[model samples]
Target: MPRLMILFTILLTVGAYLLSKALYLRYRHPLLNIVLLGAALVIATLLALNIPYQAYLPGRRIMTSLLGPATVGLAVPLYRQRSLVRRHAPAIVAGVGLGSLASMLVAGLIALMAGLPREVVLSVLPKSVTIPFAVEIARIHGGSPGLASAFVVATGTLGSVFGATLLTWAGIRHPVARGLALGTGAHGQGTAMAFMEGEREGSMAGLAMTLAGITTATLAPLMVRLLLRS
Candidate 1:
């Protein structure tokens, strides 16, 4: 029964992923985000069946492991955009650094004002970055990796849902600007959306995502300590 359940979970996850991708390409709906939709479907199904998350975590971890390779694969798009990246390196670096810092600072301030636990604030401080790096940063700052994972997922979802709209409103229309905004604010999911536009956009977005992760990882702990001290 356990083996069957694991098999079923894997099959269901794949099916949902494909279905959600199809829907996104067909309808162009923000709500049809493949990752978000697939995650929702799997979580709902598991909860309805009374399957404890822990019971399925091992199988889920198998799928999650693929995320690392998938992230590395982003180098393809980035390599393709090398010339453009070189031309705009300074702008991209500045934009991503500012955006990532702003995100962490805002989230940290809100968390502190709300009187949330210090660990929770630390966890959320790096939520705008990728999960693995965010987890490491969170742990170093005496935060919970589990909480960081949850917050990073939430940050990605919110960034994907609203990122494009916000950029348009801010008059950020160039592909480079759009990609930078998405990657800096949304991370992987946003980078995925940027790639859907073109390789150039995707490459820039990947660069932005990488820079944002590195910057946030280093600065978040310092900001947290400074904030707590003051």
Candidate 2:
């Protein structure tokens, strides 16, 4: 694409995020979540201008390339909280493993109950995982990667918006538990929210996100088989 289009797309994406983040900071509301708000603004702007999504591809790829470094940065907080993690290792393992499995089973079962197609059920099975893993798992199971991406985003957005309140209502006061729940259910968005809560929570959330991804990847095929048999 043209240099001008690339620049415009980059500015639009980053500008929307900064603006939404500012609004979120000022209002302190879950509904004003930066990711959700920023995405809405971008989509609305593109649609209003009649800009094809293809025009945004270059900038999207550039931004996506940065995700690796961004994820690696989580290690800083994880390192700082190493002692606590070691102390709580058993709980962390069990919580993340169970949480990941539960998310897949619940999503798949609900889709099956709704009489959704087999492909739709498979796509939903990895909704709680981060997009890369979710897409691959969906592809492996002959599901639509595009649909899987949508499910992952929806799951993460909703989880980031309401997860903390629900945890509090359930009397889950421990930071580790909260972080694990958020990470396993929401992935990246949840990790962002966990960081906003505190460093300790953020570190555990980072760990949980990684562990949950691994656990989901390993167990998803079996889960699909079980759901199919049901």
Candidate 3:
């Protein structure tokens, strides 16, 4: 029964994602993001069918296992853009490092000011990174990994939806700058959005995503110590 339930959920989720992707391509609208649309479709289906969320857990885990390979696949674009990356190495490093730090500091400070619990603040600190990195950081800091994952998804969704508009408003027009901002602020979903713009933008976003993950991992511990002390 559990096996059947898992298969059912996997099919449902994948089917919804395909449909959402098609719709997004047809409309070319940010609000129709595959992640956001797919998730809503899945949740609505489960609720309408009176299925317990527990029934979805096994499938979720199975699907999540693919993330590692997906991350590795990002290297393809990075390789294609290696010359550009080498040319702009110093600026890229500076941008990604500062962006990563700013995200953590801003999130932590806001959470602290709101008087959110320690664990929650910790989770929020890594919200801008990809899920795997965010989850590990949350765990190391005694934060709820589940909450950290949620925050990461929310950040990515919002970033994917409005990041370009925000960047344009801020007068950030360079491909590299825009890509770095999207990847640093939103992670996977942002990278997907970046790919829609151009290959150069997508490659830069992929690089930024990887570097930002490393930067976040390196800085999070010290940031946690400081946040705790404050």
Candidate 4:
């Protein structure tokens, strides 16, 4: 990639995020989502500039790599919430396991109902998990990583944008329950929102996210094999 193209990618990505953050702060609306807005701005800029995605891949990869450390950072708050986690270990395990299994099964069933191709079904199977784990799950099941990543983003974004409102409507106000639900459904974005709720919420959300990822990674391939067998 040209040096100029790399610079463009970095500037565009960071600039779009900053702009979206400012707007979100002003509006305080779920629709003012930074990810959705930043993605649109970045894509529009690249398209208008006639820059291909390949030119932005390096910068995008750098951004993607940051997720690893961000995920690790969740341990700090989780350490603070250790007693809470210990008290609720059984509930947490059941909640995460059920959430992970239900998500994969539902995705697979939807793909089947829609008569999508086998690879497409496999790709969608991991959509509820975080991107890195989802991509690997898709690859392990002979699916497309690009599709897996896209679906993961869509799932997380939708969940993050409206999940709290839905929880409120249902009268689910317990922080641990809310955190687990959000984390299981939305992954990183949900965890971020949970942190905004409070440290205990964030800790539970982080734990739920990790548990869901591991469960999805282990079960997605098995589910695909079962689908094939059926």
Clashes of 2: 0
Better-scoring candidate (lDDT), 3 or 4: 3
Highest TM-score model number: 3
Candidate 3, residue 173: the lDDT equals 91
Ten-residue stretch with the least lDDT total in model 1: 28-37
Over the stretch 132-164, how does candidate 4's per-residue lDDT look in tens digits?
788878988789988898888888878888887
- Arrange candidates, best TM-score first: 3, 4, 1, 2
Better of 2 and 4 by lDDT: 2
TM-score per model over all chains: 0.78, 0.78, 0.84, 0.81
Query: How far is each candidate from the true structure, as Cα RMSD in Å?
Result: 3.2, 3.3, 2.6, 2.9
Local distance difference test scores for all models? 0.83, 0.85, 0.88, 0.84
Q: Candidate 1 has which clashing residue pairs, if any?
A: none
The pairs that clash in candidate 3 are none
Give per-residue CA lDDT, model 3, range 1-230, as digits (tens): 99998998999999999999999889977666676688889999999999999889999999989777876776686787789889889878999999999999999999999999998998899999988888888989889988898899889989988898999999999998998888899998899889988987787888898789889999998999888875
Estimate candidate 3's alpha-carbon lDDT, on a 0 to 1 scale. Answer: 0.88
